[model samples]
Target chain A: MGAEFYHSVHLDVELCKGCINCIKRCPTQAIRVQHGKAKIIKEYCIDCGECIRICPHHAKSATYDSIDILKKYEYTVALPAPSLYAQFNNLDDIDIVLSALKSFGFDDTYEVSAAAEMVSEMSRNYIKKHREDAPFISTACPTVVRLIRVRFPNLLDHLLPFAAPVELAAQIAVKNAMEKSGLPREKIGIIFISPCPAKVTACKDPIGNTYSEVDGVIAIKDIYPLLLPHMKSVASDPEKCSVSGRIGVGWGNSGGESAGLLTDNYLAADGIENVIRVLEDLEDQKFGDLEFIELGACNGGCVGGVLCVENPYVAQSKLKKLCKYLPISRNHLGDEVPQGALFETEIEYEPVYKIGKNLAESLALMARIDELCKKFPGLDCGSCGAPTCRALAEDIARGFAREGDCIPLLKESILSLSETISPNQ
Target chain B: MEKNIKLSYIVSPNDFLSAGAVSEDVKAHLEEMEIDSEIIRKATLAIYESELNMIIHANGGIIDIEITPDSLNVEAADNGPGIPDIEQAMEPGFTTLKPNSDMKAKGIGKGRGLSNIRKCTDFFDIETELGCGTTIRFGIDLK
Candidate 1:
């Protein structure tokens, strides 16, 4: 909970032009332009990295874990997301990527995609047994889960109760490393190679879960530059790298999870704006027969993440080709659910931004703002330092700005006062 | 009430793309005013259902909104074909629009719109004159 305030995404004030581009693009309306710079209201932000992608000035950036962070632990294991495979073009072998990760001073590499397959299998049975009126929403994307918590509080019950693939893989990696090296659990560091800022925030301040098993999060963009030097020469043993089923590798792209379910009656949407619209439809109970609804905040799933190097379309194509070639998983962890990794705790709504402290004050404020909205122009031109005309009205009601702050209103008042003071002058 | 704010909008017919513009506007206004989150959500859902009904069923309609200290009120009047039996229409899963038809393909007339609107608001009322038009009034109390 304390780590929610420590967002990986940050704005460089010197580079911001205050053009209102980010203010308009943010899905949560967490950004505001003030004093010729943009400010992020920490509580409202879900760290989806939408502003990072839309900012033309490149003022917003995702922070990555420095290489030095791995020095503390005796054993360091790299748990790479499947999106990492989509980063390099024409990469035929999974061992090449795993070996390249080992060259970066890691003891072993674990495939998060393997864990993804297990999760998909678990979800198929969960949806079958615990049926509800609404479709079960996938909790794979941390940003999407947080969106449900903030916007659709009533639909929290609809989310599938299971740990994300990355979380499960991190715990598994740590356990395996401790067994192999005969070291204490605290000595093993399981670092996740994440494709988005949301994963970084999730690792630090996990939602629903008590604590995150992962120790550090390094952005995929940061590792891409370092791995280019090692991809040319790799280990010969293919068994050293973790390889999973084709369905798991396909999870890097949108609709991949739904396809794994083998169910025709499902809905899949990508991108934050599109996800919001789909959630609204789901709230209306339009897709009554839908067994699952897979939503990713990125445009083309993790391949289109803000912190990734490759283009989403090109990466999606590569991911598909790789999925077609990979063999299915033979190893099975039969019906037993992992003890610490299961999502057993109930997740409560995080109403970070409420109108007022109490009921009466909120009602009074609403009445005051309604009265002020009538005076402002309804065009929402954004001429008065606010994103919309209604925002300016709220500003006036909150006593943050004067009503005359509007340029048009100020001019009209001045012209009327001059005429009234001197007749026919 | 010490003060009252009134807003009116004209919903264009068959503009499936822009059907939710009015509801979105009202939701934004409620958000800016720092209204209760629960109340805003209920009002927005009711307005959204009303807007979709006006656009899909009726050719077009006039949406009149009134926001006061006590409650948020919306009155939608459409000149479309009015329902002969109000009781049956109010029942959930009683959609007149056929599946995969023109209107259903556009994702409207789910038969849950009226029932959903009724569930979201504290006060719900509808009056219709068979072949003339239909008028629906609903309010969600902020208090």
Candidate 2:
């Protein structure tokens, strides 16, 4: 909660027409309208890019490394997310995409799907071994992981304590670049062509892992325009591209990883709100039959990322079509997790609910808020600029707003006060 | 204590979608009051479990909550079919509903709710009457 690293989603203050749209849409309740502007509460923010998607004024934008940032390293390797393959039409061959990345100035392109395969294999083994009472949750989506830390802190132990596919991809890319180019580790950079902002935040300031091998993150949308013409041109020799099997590339959509796990009783939920409900059920121990749960913050999965150019459903169908072309006999990366690669770091819960400095004061404030809540209409109209009726109650209790601020309540009070002041008596 | 705060919620039966709404509201209230994190977690978990039980098993009842500087108390009263044996119901794996019963069909009854509620609260009690209803009263000391 201190001076942390950069968040993926930030407000373009100049363009912000603070309409309170993002505040209402935010699943984490991280956005607040203050002084006619929207501000993100960094402690509760998971960098899910929901604000970027919901912002009507185009005020919210995700930050990513430009192609210029990749120039600093002598050998820059681009790890294209599987979602990137689904971005183009009539491009069944993923090599064209890889080749397009190379033409876009990356020294080489590595398939992140391969790393995803490795991660999936390792996860299956882990799930089998760690057969505890609680179901194991996937860690591939950084936003979901952070959501657990923020909202569902009780279920933190259930999260699969593995490095994200992006991290694994970065590590492999860096290692491969160093081995092939004979460049020092510092001289080689691994840039992840991400479908979402969460990956960028993960690289900038890793949550679970102490250190990240990923040097930079570039959104797929940023690289898509440049790669379109290249993709249309001569396709790369399919032999040169490092391809992954159906299981790995299928991760762009929901239930893809669960299918790879080969588990009969696994639950998969996509989109931030849906994932939240699923996690609530998990918290209630409602999914007693399930052994694993896969949650993706985006609607369809990474393909539904705010930064993606393609429709999630279209991208999903394209990825599925490409999945059929994968050879029956495919290469699988060994689950050789680099030393110190696993996320052993303790992620503390966000303290958003803390009300008072001391127990006595907090109890008093809680009582006050409850009292205030009873007086206000429970309409949750959000007319008072608060997200909910309860929020307005807290605002009034905390002296940030007033009872008169509620338009309906103010009208009622005005009528009553006028009646009392009238000379009818 | 400046003023003892009280709240009442009428939880609807079979309303699975909004089963935990009351507990979430309580959590938000306690959070706004800045209660201790550990205490808040215990209270919210206990409240949520109790709320779920009322919705899934009972004929949807009312929950009354009273908060003081010293302790927080929640009394959930439901007019559904009462438990035949309170002791058995308190067990971790004991549930009145059959394995394929209505509640179990919806994945609601894991037989862990009552035990979890007991474990999370400092004080727990269940009062039930045959052919009548059940009332669960629990309290957690803020101190």
Give candidate 2 misplaced runs (Cα > 4 Å). A1-5, A236-239, A328-336, A396-405, A410-425, B1-3, B11-18, B27-60, B80-121, B126-134, B141-143
Tell me how candidate 1 scores on lDDT: 0.81
Q: How much does each candidate deviate from the true structure in C-alpha RMSD?
A: 3.5, 3.4
Question: What lDDT is reached at residue A267 by model 1?
Answer: 87
Scored by DockQ, the top model is: 2
lDDT per residue as tens, model 2, A1-425: 22373577889888887687888888876776766778887877888888898788999999888878787999999999999999888777887888777876789978888888878878877888878754888888989887787667668888888878878778778778988999899888888889999888888888887678888888899889989887766475533675688889988889988888987888889999899989876765555568889999998998999889999989999989988978622545455655444786776666555666776777677777767777889887666777776777776766777887776799898888888899484
User: Residue B61 in candidate 2 has what lDDT?
Assistant: 94
Residue lDDT tens for model 1, A193-229: 9999999988887887878989999888888988977
TM-scores of the candidates, chain A only: 0.92, 0.93
Measured with C-alpha atoms, the lDDT of residue A81 in candidate 2 is 92
Error (Å) of candidate 1 at residue A132 is 2.8
For model 1, state the Cα shift of residue A28 in Å.
1.6
Q: Runs in model 1 with CA error above 4 Å? A: A1-5, A235-239, A358-360, A378-385, A395-425, B1-5, B26-49, B56-59, B67-72, B80-101, B104-124, B129-132, B139-143
TM-score of 1: 0.88
For candidate 1, write residues B110-138 as lDDT tens digits.
Answer: 68889989999999999999889999999
